[model samples]
Structure formats: C-alpha cells, structure tokens
Target chain A: MNSMKGKPMNHKKFEQMILTPEALTSEEREELARHIATCESCRKLSLQWQKASRMLNKPLPMAAPAPGFSARFAHSIEKRKEAEQQKQVRRFITILLVSLLSAALIFAVTYYSTNSLETIIKDTANASAQMLFLWESLKAIISTVTGFLPTVLLIPFLLTAASAMLTLTLLWLVSIWKLTLQKETVL
Target chain B: MEHELQQWLDEAMQGKEESFCRLVDHYQNGVYNLCYRMLGNRHEAEDAAQESFWRAYRNLHRYDPSRSFQTWLLSIASHYCIDQQRKRRMTLIAIDEPFEETFGSNSPTPEHVYSNNEQSSQMEELINTLKPTDRAALVLRYWHQMSEKEIADTLSLSVSAVKSRLFRARKELAEKMETRREEYELHERETYEPQKI
Candidate 1:
C-alpha cells in the first residue's frame, strides 16, 4: 500500500509528466518509466493516457458533405444577394420619403410664418440676392489679399492648394466607393 | 492543384459565384469533418459547415494570401464551432448522443463498423466535455495536425496557452476514461461475485 501511494512529490511530478509526455526529457522519461514500474496508480494513468492519445491522434476518415453541397451554397448565396438588393431598395425608398417629408415640413413652416405666398416669394428672392452679394464680396476680399503676393509665388501656391483639394476629394470619393463595396459584400 | 486553387480564389475574389462554389467543392470534406468533430452530430455539423463557407465567401477579400488557405478556412470553421458550443452551453441539449449514421463508411464487416461507432461515440462524449476553446485547440492539434504555433494563431492564443489547453484537455479525457474503467470493473465484480454469498 505504501509502495502504491509512492512519494507524494514524485507522484505529482510523474502525473503531470504523464499528462504531457511529449514535454518529457529523455532522463525524465526514464525516471518516470522506473517510477511507473512500482506505482499502480501512475501506471494506470500512463496506460489510460496512452490509450486516449492513440485514439485521439489517429487520423479518422474525413467526413464528406452531402452531395450537391456547392450547388446548395450557390443557391443560398443567390437568395442572400436578392435579399440584400431588396434591403437596399427599401433603404433608398425610406430615405427619399424622409427627405420629401422634411422639405414639405420646411415649406409649411415658412408659409405659416410669413402669412402670405407673396411675402414668402419675396423673402426667398431677398435671401438669394444676399447670398450672391456675399459671394462677390468674398471674391473681392480674396483678390485684395492675393494682390499683395508676387505672381510667381501666387501661381504656384494657388496651384498647390488646388491640387491638394483635388487629391483630398479623390481620396474621399475612393474611400466612399470602397466602403460601399465592402458593405455590399459583408454578410 | 495549388495553381488551380489560386485561380479559383482569384476569381472568387472578383465576385464570381461559380468560382466560389468550386472552391467550396474542394474544401467541403475538410471543413465538414472539422465541424462534425467539434459539434458531434451530422445535422449541426452540416449547418455549421455551410455557415462557415458562407462566412468565408463574404470575407474572402480579407483573407491574406500568404497564409495557407486551408488553415484560414479551418480557422473560420473553428471559430464558428466554438461560438456555437458556447451558445449551446445554455441549452440542455444532449451532445453525447450516439451518431445516427457513421460517416465515411468503408468498413468491411459489422464488427469493424460497430467498433468504429463505439470508439467514435466515446470520443464525442469525451470531447464534448471540454471547454469550447480547449476543444478547438485539441481538434486543431490532434485532428487537423496543426502545429502548436498554428493552433495558437487559429485560436488567437499564445503558444504556451495552446500547450496548456492541450495538456488540460488530455488530462481531463484521461481522468474520464479512468473513471469509466473503474466503474466498469466495479459493475463486473458486483455482477459476478457469486451473488455476494
């Protein structure tokens, strides 16, 4: 019985080593083999591990999917694509309806606030004229500021700024295009 | 075959459905076997394998070509099965039920078939008892023949973690086998001990 129990420390060490025998060094394996010869429980543990490892590691035959698996997958993909198209159509219709509703609400508020169609029309004309005047004034201010710089510096600087803006816009558009493509492809 | 796989992958990435289906045909068995081992049933394995393929199709562009495509596909299946097992933990489903039909049936005799079924069923029971991540690690390591580093990459764990999980999983299986053996021995003793007279 005492022999069966073995030394507690050695038992724990051998037990862990048995659990992961691949990690064992040659000397450790020899030591463990000697220990197992005397220890009943460790011997049983080793045998069990060996049996389980054999069963687990053996290459069982690969299970094949049912026939026409690819055909079924293709059908499902078609269904999913159709569903996605329908979802996109629904979203577009929703957005268009919301925009129309928002425009009608704004018109209604303007009509109520002004109390007359003529007043509303006159207000719209005044707003447009004011925007045009502001634009002209902004152009004049830019010309005044640019009048101070030499033509050589101004030409290159303006060209550089324009090219930078163009690059940024291109980058933004490309990113949006890529994002839309990704959204369409994502499940 | 490698060149053909690469061609199919390129076409699939270009949104060719037929090409993607061809890729599916090539890998169905490998993916299905992984799913069957992880889920432990034919029906769920079928569904899981199909879903994994769908996911791979959707995310095909994100796949890095430098890595092995089989490894990538199996990684997707592993993650899907692990998620399924986690969700299944809440439900009281019997995962240890004997498989209704043997897969890849090429055994020559009834005895071989019966022995295969028994071993397969016992394996399923033992494997189902493991935690989902540990089970994935074990399946990838022993069944798929993935290296420890590959298993680590698949499960997104450290190699040491994979090592420990494999060790822990094997220890649990060994312990379970030991207990079952002892129970069988006890039953046999009770059954044939001269009626305790």
Candidate 2:
C-alpha cells in the first residue's frame, strides 16, 4: 500500500470512495486503503461498512410462502372473475333501466305536447324530414365551399381532417379498452 | 425447465387457471422472498406477493415474452412492495422482530438458530432504515443478485439512479451500524465499570 506521508487526506472523498467501491479505480482504491491504514475514524467506518455489506450480502435461506399458496391464488382469481361478471351484469341492468326511464319520460312529454297520438306521430315524421332537409342543405353549402377552394389546398385539408378524425377515434377506442382492462384488473 | 415454464406461461396467457397456478408455484419463493425482504414482515410480504401475482395474471397480455420471466415477476413484486412501504411510512413497524417462523426446522442447535436470528434481524433493521426505492434497489442488488441495469429496469429508474441509491443506502447502513456498535460498547462499559467498582 502507498503511504499517505506527504499528502493531506480528504476524509469525505475517501469515505465516498469506500461507500462506492465499484466506482473507484484501482489507484483510488489503493489510496483509500492507505488512508484507512492511517485514519482511525475512516478505518472504523470502513470496518463497519464491510460488516454491513457482509450482512447485506449473506445468502439466507429463501423464505417460502405458506403451503397452498397456488390454491389460494387460484381461488381469489375465481372470486374476482365471478365478481367482475356480476358487476358487468349490474351495470347492464342499470343502463337498461335508465334507457327505459328516459324513453318513458320522452313519451310522456311528447304526449302532453300533442294531445292525440296521431298528431304526435305526424309531428315526429315532420321533424325527421326537417332534419334531413337541414342535413342536405349543409352538404350543399359544404360542396359550394369546396368548389371555391383550390384543389391542392382542398385535398390536403380534407386529408388532414380525415386523418385527425381517424386518430381521435383510435385514441378514444384505445382509452376505452385500457379503462376496461384496468377495471377488470382492479376488481 | 425453461421450456416447461414457457409452455405454462403460454397457457396462462390463454387464461388457464391450472397453468397460472403452476407458474405461481414455481416462482412463489422468489417473489415471497423479495416481498419479505422489502416489506420487513412476513404477513405483509405474503399479501404483497399474492397481489403481485394477481397483477401479473391480469397483465399477462402485456408481458413481453422476450424478457426473463423471473425478472418481470420480481419487478412486479418490487414495485408492489415499494408502494406498500410508501403507504406504511406513517406506521412504524418493528424491523428487528425475530423471524423464528421463517427459520427451517433443520437448524443444528439453539445457539446457531439464535445467532442466525440475531444477525438476520439486525440486517433487516439496517435495511428498513432506507427509503422505499433505495430499499428496493438494495434488496434487489444484495438478495436478488440483480445487476444495476436490471434493478433500473425493474424500478423504472436509470442505471445511474440505481447506482446512486445503492451507494447512499450502503453509506446509511454503515453509519447506522456504527452508531449501534458505539451504543453497544458504551452500554457494556457502563455495566462493566459499575460492577468492578
């Protein structure tokens, strides 16, 4: 070992080197060794660290879980799957009930607005025709605007919009799929 | 064994309960040991191991087959234990509790058993003083024999972070050990000096 005769020792640097032995070069390690030989506190720290490292690294027998661990895990998975199916059934029933109540409420409001069932049917048909007419009118306006735009700009614009819509739809589907997976796992 | 494990993994991914249970049986010791070391208690370790398996089962589809299955399983256990440790920060559990229940019945003598338990408890106490991620890093390094890169991947940290954590953890453990030794020596001196007088 090289003696630390002429040089002033930085205990902090040596301590850090001692802590991270793997990070040290061979020369640095030798320097640390020499420092430890002379410095009492550093020597004590080094000894304690070696003891601690040995305790940490000692290979104790692996601790096994209690017997029937696999069986218990299987049972829990079964219980979870059954509970998930029940939850899905409950959610479906709730959605069905809500839809039915909404339909009933709409029927009551429509019947109250139009005294006769025949008038209600006629009014509904008229509203459908009016919506179709408005959709056609909007299409006509879009076609007129498209005609006014240059083809170069129009093609790129349409492509961008289509791609954007497709990307948004994909993102929405992926999020829903992820949420379903997460819910199942959590359950 | 690798081929058999792969076969079981494939079937488990197909949702075969028996295959998954087989996989569980093969890895339960490793998973449980990691949990026990990380959580510093058998009960919590057992629960954490079960939870980790459950998670791995649910996320089987997400598991990349190219990686080592043991590493993936241990990664799950380590993360779960880290979260448990974080939640348990407010509650102080006794880390120095003797693990007599975990000791095998084949020990040679009571003295040997006592020595082992004392050493193991002292080590556990030193390990338990670390922060959760650092503890995970140290456990993976020492107990699981995981490389720094593997520990980084397991803990979702960079290799440098894992290195720093390991270094810091070792320093802290050394300091704690030194303090405990000083206290022990002081106590012995006090008791011995008074008796002599």
Candidate 3:
C-alpha cells in the first residue's frame, strides 16, 4: 500500500523483491520503489542488492569443458559402440560352437543307426547275389557318409547352436533389464 | 523447433543418443558454471556438470516443459551439486580433518590476515564453505540474477522458501562481514591506540 495514499504494501513481499533480482513488472517496480522510499530497511537492502548485482554482473570467467571435450566424448561413445560389437561377436562365436557340437552329436546318432549289424548282414546277402554289389555298398556308404550325413549332422548342430545363442542373448537381455530396474543411480 | 526440442528431449528421456549430445552442447556452459560455483573445484565441477546433464538426460521426461528449460535444468544441477556437497561433508567429517588454514596459533589473527590479498580469496572460500543449498540460493539469486519465482521453480521449492533462504543468507553474510570489520578495527586499535594516547 502507498503510505501517502493511506494504504500499505506488504513489507514481506517488498523484501522478497529485494532478494529476487531481475526486473519486477512495472506495477511491482513502482510499488517496491514507493515502499522503499518510506522503508529504511528495505532501502538499505535494495542498495546492497544493487552492489550484489554489480559484483555478479561483472561476469566472472566460467571455464568451458576441456578443449577436446566434445571430441573425447565422441571417442568414448565410439569406444562403447566397439564394446557392444565385441559382445555381439562373442555371442556369435558361442552360437557357432554350440551348432558344431550339436552337429557332432547328430552324426554320432546316424553312425550308430546305419552301421548296425542287422543292416550289414542284409547288405552282405544282397552282395552275394550280385558280384558288383559289394563295390556298390561301399560306394553307397561313402556317399552317405560324405554327402548326406554331414548335412544331417548340420540340422541338429544348427538347432543346437541357434538355441544356445538364443539363450545367451536372453541372458544378456536379462542383465540389461536388471540394470534398468535399479533405482538411485548417480545418473 | 522449440517444441520439437521439447519433443526430442522427451524422446531423449528414453535414452536417445542424439538428444543427449544435442542438449549437452546446448547448455554445457550454463550447467558448467552452475556446477563450478557450487563445488569450487575445477575437477569436481566438471564431474558434477557432466553427471547433471546425464541425469537430466536420463530423466528428461520428468521435466515440465511448461517451465523455462534453463531454470528446470539448473534445478536439476543444483540438486546434484547439493547431494555431492552432503556426501563430501559427510566424507570429510568421517575422515576427521580440518580444511587447510593460513592462520595458526603463532600466525596473525584474522584481523592481520584481512590486510592481505588472501582476504578476498578467504571471503570467496568462506562463501564456498556454505551449505550447497544456501550457496546455491546465493549464487543463482546474485550471480545468475534469477527471479525468486524462477529460482523457486528451479529448486522445486515454494517461493517463500527461496525468499526465506535469501533473507537468512544475506543476514548471515552481513554478520560475517560485520564481524570481520570489527576484528580489523580491534587490530587497528591495538596497533595504534597506545601511540595515540
């Protein structure tokens, strides 16, 4: 309130304006000015605030980030990208190994089944009837071993490799999930 | 584009690389200055500034665009800095040692020390000694010239809280300055009073 007008401004609010720098609205500025003219304490604080403004406004030198900061930051980002690629590469290798192991296991199964005694005896009888049958049997076995077995071997091997890979991928995903689930990180 | 910045910032909250880098560059100096003034150590300031931005980036969605961007961001940095100070003070107390001092039992008193250039530095050092929250209220209000409302918004405090702090800080600074002035007068009287008599 304007004292001369037989009213009063809120002393608390005027003091707040002194504490808060930056321009108050024109109406606020006028009110504060009128209040300060009548209020010695507010007037003194206003002067102190002016000095504070001048000191701070002189513009102290603020240091920038390191000269190569952006570049170094980019470098770190690249480093992280490389680490991720390396992790992916490790995963791919693990899958490859599992696939090869599964292939070996399937090969073991085929070897036992086709090389059974019953099957060999039947083949021998057939060979007795045909003079060239033994040669044909050996050729058939060689072809099956070389051509069909490896492919058959690959089927289970690929599945094993793929399944293991999927499991590992899920584990990696789970760790990241746990990381995100964490509360109260520094950032 | 400004709104897009806001949108990008929102997306960035989800950990968008592009927005993080962009926002970092956009406000690095402002953020760095706030941290530097808050911490009073270059290295710590750098770390604080970096971490504050990362935190803001991590929690960008929580930012209210209805508020000024800089004020909102400064608020985050202020909290980060305050937390650091609390941790530092706790750690310092835990270790149990006084900060280095030029005054010793044989050394000149604060009155004598006031005559030297060290006085200004000492005053600055003393200012830095204030709790981070108090120092922040002082720095942002005096140094950055933020409005009380802006500061309140920045710190997530009510406007009255900001005003109360500012008032207390002023009274505190004045009291310290007043005490130092008295000490200097006492020293002058001791050194010259006998001769005058």
Candidate 4:
C-alpha cells in the first residue's frame, strides 16, 4: 500500500517489474516510483527484489560438452536410424514367412482331409474324452492307494497340498500385480 | 541473418543433412547448456540435447515456421530433460564429486575448485531442490534470458503458468538464501565473540 494515497501495489506486480523492467510502461514506471518513494515497506521490497534479480543475473559457470560431441551425436542418430530399418526388415521377413507357412499348412490340411469337417471334429472330440477317462482312472487308483494310509498322515498331506496351492496362488497374484505396474510405468 | 537462417531451415526441411548439421553447430552450445542447467549433469545433458535434436529432425515437418526455431528446439530440450528428471529422480547433485567420477561434476581446475564462491554454488544447489518443471522454467527465464512468452510457448504452457512456476522457484531460492545468510551471520558472531573475550 502506498500509505500516502492508500493504494496498494501487489508485491508480485512489483516483482514482475524488477524481473523485467522493460515490461513496465512509462506511466506504470512513474506510479511504481511514486509508491516506492512514499511507502517504506514497498521501498524495502523493491530493494530486496532488485537484489534477487541481480543474483539471478550472475554469470553461470558453464562447461562445454566433451570434444566431438556433435559428431558422436550424429553418429548415434544414424546408428539408431539404421537399427530401425533393420528391425523393419526383420519384421517384414517374419510376417512373410509366417504367412507362407500358414498357407502351406492350410493347403496340406485340405489336401489330406478326405473326411468331412464335422466327422473330423467329432472324432477328435471322442479321442479327447477317452484320454480324459484314462487320466481319471489313473487318479482313482492313486487315491485308493493313498486312502490306505492312516488318517493322521493323510491330514498332514492334505494340509501340505493346500498350503502349496495357496503359496502358488499368492505368487501368481504378485507377479500379475508387478507386471501391471510395469506396464503402467511404461505407458 | 534470420532470412539466411530461414534459407537453411528450408533446405533442412527438404532433407539436406548438411544444412541440418549447420543448425546443430549453430545451436548446440545453447541446447547443451539448457540441458545441463535442467539436468544438473553433463553426460545426461549431452544425451538429452542429442535426443532433442533427433526428435526435432524427425518432427521437422510439424514445426511451424512462424514460431522461432530456437524456441522450438529449446522446447524439445526442456521437455526431454523434464521427462528424464521424472524417470531418474535426479534431485541430488553430486557437485563435490570429481569430474571424472561424476559425469558432469564441476571440473576440478585448481582455480575453479579453490576459487569457487559460496553464494553462486549455494544458488546452484538451491535450484536443484526445485521440481523438474519449475527448475526448467527458472533456467529458461534466467539463464537463457527467454521472455515469459517464449518460456510459455517452449514449455507448452500458458504464460501465467510459466509466471507462477518462476515465482514459486524464486521464492523457494530466496528463502534458502535467507537461511544461509542467517547461518553465516551467526557463525561470524560466534567467532568474533570468542576473540573479543
């Protein structure tokens, strides 16, 4: 506040002038001068701001880049560009090979198939069911043998199995959480 | 001079590598120094400066000729440095470490090491305490002498945002300087008091 006129000038406005005096118009400069001349607080603030501005303007000790920085930088850019082109070429080749292999596989499958699609699918399904049945019978036999053991031993075995499954599940959840965090950071 | 520079820019836009190299030679010092100030390290600054130029080259087509090219280039440098600071969290500057040990430590010329004044070094350390964006704003304004508008354009921010960041940074530095000054005064009084007794 200019105590003389009871008009307040914000310190920020005064600071802006100190930082960039060229920004002030002639009339604003006159106003600022009159305020500083009359307002003790504003006068002190102006001096402090001017000192801060001078400190900011002090010459910085700058170090140049290592010798041949530009040449090395250009070389790195060229190397990166070349690497990108090579990556593209590799990608194209992989796509072409995958397409060709798929086409060949389709051709072979169609040429070899004398049965209808429905019959083939049905036969495959039946084979899978028979294998599942065999796996179930093997599990039944193992259980029957383990069933012969004492109940006390069987309880511990079951408890161990449960704890192992729980550990595995927790580890899986942690790994998934880590992966999601990594993906978020990358994005 | 700007007309001649524009001619080079036109050639560079047309894929004239030599013309682009000329641009690199012309502005490398400023770009490197900006990166150095922003990152507070030499090797990273060099890396950032180089990456900025490469990005500028790749995106030269998107550059608006109506804007200043130097500002555009510096914008790239500051943005890259800001991201690097974010990822690396480079808040601590190992200034006292020897130059060979640290990528951009103050070089150990006997004169530079022995003759270093406390105030400027303190100022440098205080600047490192700022957030990456605020530090970049201060560097662009004070070191590069960029106008507020230029800083705003370079950082892709509004002018008021740039001003606020500058104000916040300066406020923080001033507070630190005040504390340091008080500490020095206290030390001086203690030493003189013992001698007087």
TM-scores of the models, in the order given: 0.67, 0.68, 0.49, 0.61
- Which parts of model 2 are misplaced by more than 4 Å? A1-13, A22-24, A37-41, A86-187, B100-108, B182-197
| Local lDDT at A166 for model 1 | 49
Candidate 4 runs further than 4 Å off:
A1-51, A87-187, B1-4, B97-118, B181-197
How many clashes (backbone atoms < 3 Å, residues ≥3 apart in a chain or on different chains) does model 4 have?
0
Error of 2 at A19 (Å): 2.0
RMSD of each: 14.9, 15.8, 16.8, 17.6
lDDT for each residue of candidate 4 in B1-20, tens digit (9 for 90 to 100): 77878888999999987778
Best by DockQ: 2
Q: Where is model 3 chain A poorest over a 10-residue stretch in terms of lDDT? A: A178-187
Assess candidate 1 and give its TM-score to the true structure: 0.67
Interface-residue RMSD per candidate?
Answer: 2.4, 2.0, 7.3, 4.7
Candidate 1: tens digits of C-alpha lDDT, residues A1-187: 3265454445767878998888899999999998888888888889999988877866565666778888888889978776876686677557655755665566556445634566457656875786688669757866886989886577555545545544554454455445544644673
The local lDDT score (0 to 100) that residue A107 gets in candidate 2 is 52
Candidate numbers sorted by TM-score from highest down: 2, 1, 4, 3
lDDT of 4 by residue, A140-173 (tens): 8659858787865775565455455445544544
Clash count per candidate: 0, 0, 4, 0
- DockQ of candidate 1 relative to the true structure: 0.34
User: Clashing pairs in model 2?
Assistant: none
Residue-level lDDT tens digits of model 3 in A1-187? 2344567656667867775645478888888887788887778767765644444444344446655544444445656656766687678778777866665466446434545477447645663566376458756765665565576466455556556655664454445334433521423
Per-residue lDDT of model 3, residues B73-135, tens digit only: 788889998998888773111212222222335655557544433343334454675666878
Better of 1 and 4 by TM-score: 1
For residues B33-83, could you state the per-residue lDDT of candidate 2 as single tens digits? 999988878788889999999999989999998888889999999989988
Error of 4 at B80 (Å): 0.3
DockQ of each: 0.34, 0.39, 0.10, 0.14
Q: Write the per-residue lDDT of candidate 1 for residues B19-82, one digit (tens) a residue.
A: 9999999999888888987888888888999999999998999999888888889889999999
